[model samples]
Structure formats: C-alpha cells, structure tokens
Target: MRVHSLFLYPVKSLAGVEVSVIDLDDFGPVGDRRWMLVNDQGEFVTQRKLPALARIGTGIDERGVSVHIPGEGRFHLAPGHEELSVLVWRDWMNSLIGPKQASAAVSRFCERSLRFVYMPDDTFRRVDPARVVDQKRVGFADGFPFLFANQASLDELNSRLKHPVNMRHFRPNIVISGAEPWSEDHWQYLTIGQARFKAVKPCSRCVITTMDPDTGTKDPGTEPLRTLSTYRKTQDGVIFGQNAVHQDGDHLSVGDAVIICPQES
Candidate 1:
C-alpha cells in the first residue's frame, strides 16, 4: 500500500511534527519519542495526568530541537553529540515520595508528577528490558522506535464516525493506504523496503486518542474505539494499532511500499 503521511514526536506527549520524509532505525523513527517529561523522581508523565502538555509546541531545524511554552522562553536542545547521559523514568517516580511537597513542585508546571529531560545522541542506553540491545539510541518512547498505522483502517473508522476525523488523532509513524481497514491487526510481520518489523503486541487505547491533536479537545465518543471495544477488546481492554519491534534497519519515506506477511496458523 501507499503511505499517505509521516509523523515524528520529538518529545513524548507533546504535539508531533509532520515530516515529508523520515529515516527509520531499529526502534522506529530516528527522532520520534526521543524526549519525555518526567517528574523529579524520574517518573514518566503524560496528558492522562496533565492535559496542558498539549499546549507545548515543538519545532526541529538545523540548530536542533526547539520547544515553546506560553510564558516560558523557548528552550533548545543541542544536536546529538559523542557524550551520553543516563536518564531513567523510574528515578523520577522515586522523587514523588514527599506527599504534597513533591506534588507542589510538579503541579506548578502541570497536574502530573512530571519533569523534562533530554538525552544527548552520544548516550548509550539500553531498552527497559535491559536485554534488548538498543544499539540504536532512542529518546522517550516506552520501547520500539516506530509505530505504523494503515490509512484504510482510519478511513473505515471515519466512515463509521458521525464526523470525519483526520489521521492526526491516531498519531502513527507510518500510514499505509492499500490495506483493508484494521488489516494491520492481523499482520504478523511487515517488510517495508529492507526493514522488517514484527507485530509484538496490540496497543491499548487511552484518553490520548480521544483528545484532538489540533484543538486538544476530547472527542472519542464514537466509532472505531467504540466499535473496536465491542469485539477487539482483549481480556485486558480495547486494543487498537500494533506495537512493532524492528528486525532490520532501513530508511522509510513518504511513499515506501509496505509488504505485509500473513500470519501462519
């Protein structure tokens, strides 16, 4: 199928930047989910706890990454370097032990126990499991580098919705056009060019999906998630999208053809 759009989130939970072309590494997009807001204890924070993160703006250029908040002056992160920094989400979680004292520190910024940290390119860190050799540096994603979605699936969901929704709501790294609606759900492995990705798990739906990336308004009271919940619900919860682990290193662009390999039963 054809790719309709490409997106990368330089900072986790903040708005994503649309790109004309993107380079794919082992995890996903090169710069996608590279930064995250953590608390003093190094715990992860997101819109679920603080919706205002939606207000943060981000831009990338030759100078590196730039972030803009309403009253706060713009902050820029330097490009990847040879040195490395070790930042952990678990560290931020431990800093929340002091009741309101700790909450106060974070509340000043947002409702969640979250702070911000940036990793230099030279930093060599392993994925959480500590076993998956993350030779390819990653930023702030839970794991994996890329998240791919099918345009046909979104179109089918929109057909069922009262109003048409744009691809922004789903926030995917890759969008394939030829596949059937939700066909990605059945994909066991996908090969795009020379890159290989294995569908490891079904991504659980969260409040973030309901919020409009453009207006930051909640609007998931419709089909797709609703329809998916009716049947796609796992024993745990309603699931959408597949989380993939990269098997090969390849560069992905706007029009790359994705080949889906069927699951052998």
Candidate 2:
C-alpha cells in the first residue's frame, strides 16, 4: 500500500507534527515521542489524564523541537536532552522513578513536579510483564513512540458509519493507503524502505480513540470500534490498531513502497 500521511509526536500526549518523511531508527522515528511529562513518581502522563495536552502543538525546525499552546507561549527543547541517564518503570508501586528527569521546559508546560527526558535509540530499557527488554531506545512514550495504521481500514469503518470520522481520532504515526480494510490486522511484518517492523500485538482501544480530535468531544456511538468489540476483545481489552516492535532502519518517506509479508500458519 501507498503511504497517505506521516506524523510524529515529539512529546507524548501532546499534538503531533506532520511531515513528508521521517528517519526511522531502532525505537521508531526520530523526534517522535522522545520526550514526555511524568509526575514526581516518574510515571508517564498523557491526554488520558490531561486532555488539555491535546491542545499543545509540537514543531521541529533546524534549531530543535518547539512546543506551543493556544494561550501559552512557545518553548524550545535542546536535542538529546534526556540522554544523561536511564529511566525505568517500577511495577511494585506502578510509578516511574528514574535517574533521568524531565527538562525545565517540560516541567513548566505541565506545571507539575514532572520531568521530561529523551531515551537514545541505542539505550536498552525493560518493560514489565512482557519481560521483553526493548533495546531500541524510546523517547517519552508509554512503550513505543510510533503507532502505524492503515487508511483502508479507516475508510472501511467510515463506510459503515452514519457520520464520517477523520483519521485524527486514530492518532497514528503512519497512515498507509491501498490495502484492504484491516489488512494490517493480519500482517506479521511490514518493510517500508529500510525500516522493518514486527506486528507485536493488537492495540487496545481507549477513550482517546473515541474522543473528537477537533472539537475535543467524546463520542463513541460509532461503528468498527463498537463492531470490533464484539469479536476483537482480548483478555486485556478491545483491540483496534496493530502495535509494532521495530528494529533500526533508514529514513522513510511518502510514496515509499511498503512490502507486507503475512505470517505463515
């Protein structure tokens, strides 16, 4: 399938930036969710708790990353700001305490005792339960920074809906067109340009997916998600998009041909 659009979330829970091309590293895309806001306990924060974060805008220029709010002024962040140390997620207390902390700009924006930091792509961090330590460095993501979705799937959902929905509701890092609806659901691995990604799991749906990205209103009286709940419900929850764990790769651009290889039975 052909790529329709590309996006990056420089910081988690905030509005993302649209780009034509992005450099795909081991963790995901460069500058994508490389920074995040966390409370004093070091747990990552997001729009799920702070919906206002959805109003924040992030941009990348030659200088570096810049954050902008509707009424709040702009703040710039230095590159590799969170590379000083490592941050770990503690399961005993369900909090994030770390040797690394959030940047001052991030602290001011969130207006809490939270710190923001970046995790270099070369660093290794452990995620609980899975015991699958991710060597591909992640920025300020809950787990992975990039979430890829298929445009055809969205179209299929919209076709069954009374009112149309924009892709913004899905908040994906990459939206590829030309594939059959929900084709990504069965894809075992996808190779776009030099980037290689393994479809690890089905991403569960949250209120965030039901929220109106433009008006900031919550509405789930729609199809697909509701229809999906009928059968796609996993032990964890209802599934929507496919989550991917990727290895390092070169830059991926629009119009780049995506190679899809389904898993063997």
Candidate 3:
C-alpha cells in the first residue's frame, strides 16, 4: 500500500490542513493539534458542541500558527504571557493562553468566549495509560497521536450509504489507499516510509463523523456512522479507523510505501 494523503490539524477540532510531507517530533506530526480552543472555564471546546468551528480556517507556517474567521478577520496566533490550567478530557494540562485580540476575534465568530491555548514544549501529556504503557507524549489530540484510515474501507462504507462521505469527515492523519475494505481492523503493525506505528486501538465513531468537513452540517439521515454501527460496532463503540502510536522515525510523505503485518498467530 501507499500513503494516499497526509493532514494536520494545527488546532484541535478545527478543519485540518493537507500537506505533501510532515516532520515529526515526539508528537505525531510537527504542526498537528498543538493549539486548541478553550471556554471561559478553560475546558476544551470542539466541533462536537459547535459545528460552526469547522468553518474556521487554520494554517501553520515556519514562524507560527494563524486562524481565519469568516467576515471577522484573520489573526496570527501569539502565545500570551499568562499561563493557565486547562482541561482536555480527563487530563488537566498547562497551556499558554493566546493573545486577547485573537481570542476575542474567534469569540465573536463563535458568539461565545473562547481562548486559543497553545501546548508549549515545556508541557508534556502522556499517552492514555490504559492503552499505552510507554512514556510517549501527545499534543492536544484526543488520545493517540496518529489516526489511520483506509481508502477502500471508505469506499465500501460509501457504497452502503445513500450519500457518500469523504475521508475529511473522519479526519485521519494518514490515508492508505491499497488496503482492502476494513483490512485495517486486522492491522497490528505497519511501516510507512521509515516511521513505524503500532495499531493501538480501533477508533470509535462519534457524531462528529456525521458532519460535513466543509460546511460542518450534519447529514440529514445520520449516515456513515449509522451504517458503520450496523456492522462495525465493537465492544469499545461504533468503530471505523485505527488509533496508532508513533514508534520511531521523524518523517513521512505522501506516496510513501506502506508495509503491514498482522499480529503473529
């Protein structure tokens, strides 16, 4: 198989940026999910609650990150002086509140008070202890650093749905094209280019998948997830893709050769 595409979400729960290549650090992708939107209480906010966030454009460059709010304006995010405590799932983390102007601009767009928070190099959030025993870290992602999805699997899912959805709806970091439908369910280890990844857990589906990546509107019939749950439901939840942990290496690119192996019998 080959790497079909790569994507990075500079800010968690916002539209992602597609790239031809990605540099890696301890975090899965160099610019992936290092920034997040938080509420007045410092609780992480996401598209799950406010689907309109998907309309906000995010970009990353050599210097830093920026966000473009429709009609409001575009602002290059700058780390603010104040350090604040924030909540991401069950974990409480240290994050730098971004500049007041940027926060206020985004707040106007969302019609609520929201702050852009950055995960500085000094802060370290470990992988979920129940799933990974290693001391590896993640940025602002929900769990593991990488999410892998198969194109054939999406094709198969599309075939069963009245309206087909694209990979963006599911938000995978690595899109592999050559695998068969649902073949990733059996994938235990994979080598994409020089970096390796362990298929740590099957990613469970959520309502977010039912939202269009472009408009952030829910499918009228509640598709893909609805079809997937009919047959893909596991003990964990309605499942679709695999959550992976970066094993080693520092970079990967589109069209890189992908080699896979199932767990030994």
In order, the Cα lDDT scores of the candidates are 0.65, 0.66, 0.91
Flag the better candidate by TM-score, 1 or 2: 2
Model 1 lDDT per residue over 141-201, tens place: 6554556777777777777677777777666777778888888778888877666776766
lDDT of 3 at 22: 85
Measured by TM-score, how close is model 2 to the native structure? Answer: 0.79
- Taking the tens digit of each residue's C-alpha lDDT, what string does model 2 give over 116-163? 555554455433336235544445565555677888877777776777
For model 3, the run of ten residues with the poorest summed lDDT:
256-265
Question: Could you tell which candidate, 1 or 3, scores higher by lDDT?
Answer: 3
Instruction: Please give the distance, in angstroms, between residue 22's alpha carbon in candidate 1 and its true position after superposition.
Output: 1.5
Model 3 clash pairs are none
Using TM-score as the measure, name the better of candidate 1 and candidate 3.
3
User: What TM-score, computed on C-alpha atoms, does each candidate reach?
Assistant: 0.78, 0.79, 0.97
When superposed on Cα atoms, how far off is each prediction in RMSD?
5.8, 4.5, 1.5
Best by lDDT: 3
